[model samples]
Target: MPTDAHPAAPRPAVDHDVLIVGGGHNGLTAAAYLARTGKRVLLLERDDHLGGAAVSAEAFEGVDARLSRYSYLVSLLPQRIVDDLGLDVRLVRRRFSSYTPDPRDPSRGLLVDGEADAASARDAFARVGAEGDAEAWQAFYAETARVAERLFPTLTEPLPTRAEARSLIADEHAWDAFVERPLGETIDARFADDLVRGVVATDGLIGTFTDLDDPSLDANRCFLYHVIGGGTGDWDVPVGGMGAVSGELARVAREAGAVLRTDAEVVAIDGDSGEVRWREGGVDRTARAHVVLAGVAPVVLDRLVAAAAGTASGATEPSAGAAASVAPRDEPAAGAHSDEVPLDAGARHRLARAGMPEGAQVKVNLLLTRLPRLADASVAPEQAFAGTFHINELETQLDAAYRRAAAGDLPDPLPCEIYCHTLSDRTILGTGLAESEAQTLTVFGLHVPDRLVDAHGNDELRERLRDAVLASLDSVLAEPIADVIAMDAAGRPCIEVKTTRDLEHALNMPGGNIFHGTLSWPWLEPGAEAATPADRWGVATAHPRVLMCGSGAVRGGAVSGIGGHNAAMAVLEEELP
Candidate 1:
């Protein structure tokens, strides 16, 4: 909880001019934009805490405290790095409004789900031919805020190159009326119902595993209409929980000199011939830098980059002739971390390790003694989100939970979004951060893709997927969450048990599939990601001076870390661009 960086201990030559490796929040926004420009950065964090799910703890030593773990939420976190990292001073506020219980609208369980979703989207835009209040919901929020201001400068720029989106697409119409509409036929031609076209087509298909009747799930609702737009309506929070946005981006990555070690634990990274054969917590070191920026999960870097490109007998088969004879193509570098790391190779490298799973979106936090009170009596005790709930329910119950996740099964109708900023922040849960009758409630339940733990009812399918997601939150909290119980901690609860397969033994990513690969839209087409697929995964295919960011490198997954902010701006354009 006290983070300004540098305190996780047991260090030595775990090396780095820049090493990063998962301190989340896009590895602290690429170590506060690459240690402010000086560059000898180090940042590790296997966890001595630094806001991974944007943190906020004390699950039950008393009760009631919550954040987006109810799949914690953040909407386009930039606002000039939230006013150059002041983060609206320790931000926290959850009482959100978004619900749908549907047994055929039984009074939509009590409507006030966002003012009955903004008066059923202005009587679904005055019955589709548009025109109603706030001038037809301000011309449908001014054409969804011009498709969220030209898709928020290409979702934070970086991926340019269709000749840079065709020279930023000639005289813009906002890229021809919002990136080529379609999103469930532009919300069923401006809604009327189907619950406001299933909440504007469920944020254009959230972090892809696609299903709101699929067609690339209407680009996940044009990427949640660009976090629903900032004059305030989407979400953002920082303040005293979720470790104050990783303690102010680790105090802007230690006032930009950067070196935070904290509970160290490198164990061994060894990319060999080029350097970085680290070993921290137990000792045995060696450095010169093998470039890391990890945020982990690409099958723990193909078994720590094939045990740092194996020099002395380490092949329990990477095969393809032992990954080109333990990486030779001109010996790039990296090595260490052995005593054979396998557990399904860490689940087949969390399932093939390609990229983007929306940071595995499964967080649950609850510490309660009572105070969720929401069966929807038309909602207004300060518009009740006290502090948050973002679930976009019903589009055939979230496309039958992604058609039971394309067939692996784990969704008996479950798709959630919630928040509890201890009933409106007041310096962390209305002061007394809930330590006596209980407080903490955060649930972001989306299961049906990675089957959270049923390798065969393992520990009774992890408590039958946490009592079938608290019996689907007893179908909307008007009274029975048994007055908010006490203590529960799923966030990183030991690599999220059910299996971290020996803290991700190595390539066992199959059922773990934490996006070492596969957001599969033809692996993001157009030049199809630079390397791997035979180009031999990145960091210059072993180590050119090293560069590879987590969720297993390459535009991988959409936890929106952009593979450690585009591998720390391509290692600051190869050392000082």
Candidate 2:
């Protein structure tokens, strides 16, 4: 197999065919693919551990639970990446799709069982006075399934034009509902029940903070990504937690002869000369490469390149809750950053438009003594919490919450969802914990924008938001959720709440925007350019030698490796010596 000579030898200066910044899952993926082609690949990560957000950690002190700390669940990960790398990753499909308790009556709710018969689901819908929605729900997802079948395959291929993608989807009605019009209008037209409509709309608002009726239709983009995963949109639990996914990728990359280094922070990159400078353990170093794959947000890339050209300002660290506004799509005027290092005009425009990304959700992890009882008597607690358990997310409630949050006030009865990881996979629990029937709960709160964190300090807002979220969950439960929380060894409550500000400090994610930045349309606009191979693959930067291999890439989002895969494909298209 092709390998970097003397893999363990330390070199002050070395030249590699490909140098990747950030050892997140995407970086690892790019390294494995490039190294398998006999190219010398070097990956550097700022954190001591490899995985970025996709990792499992023993969060509670003296608690034996290994929770998927940041990013939970697996949906968009392609089977192709697994087969290509021969990764030993197992994902467990939850039998239930989601259970949303009715806000008007906690005892009545809708439970969607994936393994149940059509009549069973219809009965559940009937209980919530949404019997008419059962047929509409199936039809809506059926259309998405068709779109998924067509659109998912193009993710790994070269960029498809707007016209090309529309043609591929074939169904004009489906395209109009998801691609052309605002999602709110379509949901309003199709579904009659508020709770049922909210169930569908929740997918649109996951990490994005946007009004459903916004003409820009950014929510449509987010919704499309949620429903098109793995051509089925079935979010499965990763066996042994999210860390297993990254661990397998790291292993495959290492075994394929890629050099991986942790705690190495890349400070600058000279795009013209392909020189990268990084600091590790208080020691500064440099390396040259034929190509550089930036596995970071676009805004961060601009800062690095600016620093290399000596045109950057004194402020190197990104501020918390950076610009929460949606980036304008129009090409911005010049005179922002300098024009050195072949920074493309459009790339600069994108940077200027990209204010700090604003992540919208608040994540709270809890290790519970046992599953809390649901108010809905017909459905057992195990069945309701197994999948996504949504609370206070009715269509009207979601809109009202957005209004309140946009007005700089915290939404009362915060809309959120809960996922019981232990229900599907018991291995995440320690031997003692598992034997005692302990469970782990991952709560994701919607409409909790970074702006709130900016208005209220992280410490203050964390507690307030945590209280609000638990209260919302409590609204649907038989007893208070706080009573069931397991205590850590030190007598502290085993609850971990991460606000966007917290994410920014912990993960170097500017604005804590989970997708790196607002997600872009998978296909280029009608008149957009795609002249180069990198451009065609949607991984291009201003510099020809540099490409994006992170969530910031056109088709990149969630746990999917499309960005890295396409970046490798783009590099492989060129003849490399």
lDDT of each: 0.48, 0.86
lDDT of 1 by residue, 457-504 (tens): 445555555565666676665666645554334322211212222112
Task: Pick out the ten consecutive residues of candidate 2 with the lowest summed lDDT.
Answer: 319-328
Give candidate 1's whole-model lDDT. 0.48
Which ten contiguous residues of candidate 1 have the minimum total lDDT?
319-328
Q: Compute each candidate's TM-score over C-alphas.
A: 0.31, 0.91
Model 1 TM-score on a 0 to 1 scale: 0.31
Candidate 2 residue 132 Cα shift, in angstroms, is 1.5
Per-residue lDDT over 1-577 for candidate 2, one digit per residue giving the tens place of the 0 to 100 score: 4368646644234499999998888989999999999999999999999988899999999998899999999988899998998999999999899999999999999999988789987898999999999999989998999999899888888888998999999999999999989999999999999999999999999989999999989899999999999988889999999999999989999999999999999998877777899999999999998888989877677667767877553133231112322222233323444556555765654554456678898999999999888889888999999889999999999999999999998989899999999999999988999998689999999998887875787899999988998899889999999899999999998999999988877877767789988788889887766888788888888777778898888888799878888888888987655
